[model samples]
Target: MKGRLFLIPVTLGSPDYRYVIPEKVLEIIISLRKFIVEDIRSARRFLRMIDPRFPIDESEFMILNKHTDYKDLDGMMSFLKEGSDTGLMSEAGIPGVADPGSDLVLQAHENGFRVIPLIGPSSIYLALMSSGLNGQNFAFNGYLPIKRADRIREIKNLQTMARRGQSQIFMETPYRNMKLLEDIAATLDNNIYLCIAANITHPDEYITTRTVSDWLKKGFPDIDKKPAIFIIGIKS
Candidate 1:
């Protein structure tokens, strides 16, 4: 028998934002005999938030941290051989985008298991849509370097592309937002336009675009440690 797999996207839970998992999707979550999650604890927490009535026994869920050794492609292959349906979910955003669930998807595909990706909220794309940047030509550069020198070099390169009219989107942990903003203010040209989309889809959501010099003068958006997506662009 052929095994089945569902790739579900989950938005990070927040008081300001209540993500709506469709009834059909919730049904899938409830009915699945096994789940392969990026973080087992987080997945359980999300399940509890979604429906307290839904009972998720510990034995029914499998933790698959892609960074750890448990992400053995061979093991996944063996699991699929048993014809068990598996569900993949990340902590936030869509699974297999920046999340570690892509490996399982690839392995499952190689073994000929049917794979399906469910539509859900994506903060990155949402940021791009609202950002007054060149969406026609945009790139998501993922996380920038931690080291100042490396990050500076990377930002300089991205700035050059922005000047040519390519919107550059990147993200950092909530606590690092201030540092990342500081780096942008220091390195980029004062006239260059930058957009910061913070806490998207949440009640306190903020999307603002301003020149580097203006942003410095105004002291950046006061995003209170919320997940954010930052986009830089040279206005066309």
Candidate 2:
């Protein structure tokens, strides 16, 4: 009998998991003895935060990240192949979305393992909810180009889609957030609205939506070196 796979979600730097993670989900996280995680240190830290008495030293862990070799994915299923249920956890937020956890999930499915996704805070959805943008039809454009020239063109293309009523959602590495915001201010159309959601679910959380022109005149908060979500879409 092959074991099932549980997708674990972690807090968004809130420290208080009770608000974002379900009690049952925390219980499931505590029950697991083996895990496939993006970062071993942070995963262990999250488990410890969930329950101080959790058997950290005894728990088995396999590192899975963007750097993980594809050839080694099948080997990650060894525990499941042995009928031992394992959990797949992300550094933050839920597993799979915009994270390397999706690769392992795909391997698990192809190997015939039951996959269970637990309910938890998703920054993408949360940002959309508060951004006052089109929630029904939207696309998550994970990350834009690193080069300024390439990024400007990408933002323009996404803005074009926004005019048609489909929201364009994207994010950037924490350190580069300020640069991305500056580019958005200069490149995005003033008529369309722009939303910048930073430090989501954290104590210093900030989410705001306004016209590009308004933002340019009023300026905005300092979101430098912070995790953020940027959305460009029509208000109506």
Candidate 3:
């Protein structure tokens, strides 16, 4: 019995070649046996949208989310121990990046399961490419602190790195994008360049680069309720 795992990233709901899963990758999904998804419901919806004929049964799906309890983890581990080939899929984007699938991957690896990641859309790298910032060196700070003071302190430290020509990237829940933008405007220097890449690969996608001051004056764009990524760069 051989234990195997596949990391599948669901970029947007569609399978566009540019920034979402490529055509070749779509074939991989059709052949997978077991699916370990962040949100089993959402994963099912996405799969239906991609291809209505996709053979994914609800029973074969396993939920591995952040809020998963110990019992769930133990059950999943037991399933993996039976030499099952599993597929890890996030609600959106690649598994193990900003998703809870990272822990599952680590656990699988520790248990001697073979882990393979298929290339797909990553908003972090896409934001970096379009940010017009220092691409040679960059760090994805993941999500920022929720508390005002802590977030400010974290941004200040990130500001220091940006000033030295390091690109700093981070994201927030879709609904909190405006709040995150406001914080950046208030705390970051006027001259620092900021890039807001929203809804990447989506129908109404937007990517813009401007100074913090200019962004403040113009007010944050009407991003509505869409997934977005933010990148900040301080002139060296």
TM-score of each: 0.90, 0.98, 0.90
Q: Model 3 reaches what TM-score against the true structure? A: 0.90
Look at candidate 3 and give me any clashing residue pairs. none
- Segments of candidate 3 deviating more than 4 angstroms: 14-19, 70-74
Q: Residue 17's C-alpha lDDT in candidate 1? A: 22
Order candidates by TM-score, high to low: 2, 1, 3
Listed per model in order, the count of residue pairs whose N, CA or C atoms clash below 3 Å is 0, 0, 0
lDDT of 1: 0.80
lDDT of 3 by residue, 1-236 (tens): 87578888686644564456777777777667678888878888777766788777643888888898744665676556777767889977889988788888888887788888988888888888887888998999999999988988898889898988889999888888887777888799999999999988878779999998888788789775778898999654
**29-64, model 2: which lDDT tens digit per residue?**
899999999999999989988999999999999999
Count of clashes in candidate 2: 0
Worst 10 residues of 3 by lDDT: 11-20
Model 1 agreement with the true structure over 95-190: per-residue lDDT tens digits: 888777778888888878999887777888888988888989999998999998999899999999999999999998788888888888889999
lDDT of model 1 at residue 55?
70
Write down the RMSD of all candidates, one decimal each: 2.2, 0.8, 2.3
Runs off by more than 4 Å, candidate 1: 16-20
Q: Model-by-model lDDT, in order? A: 0.80, 0.93, 0.81
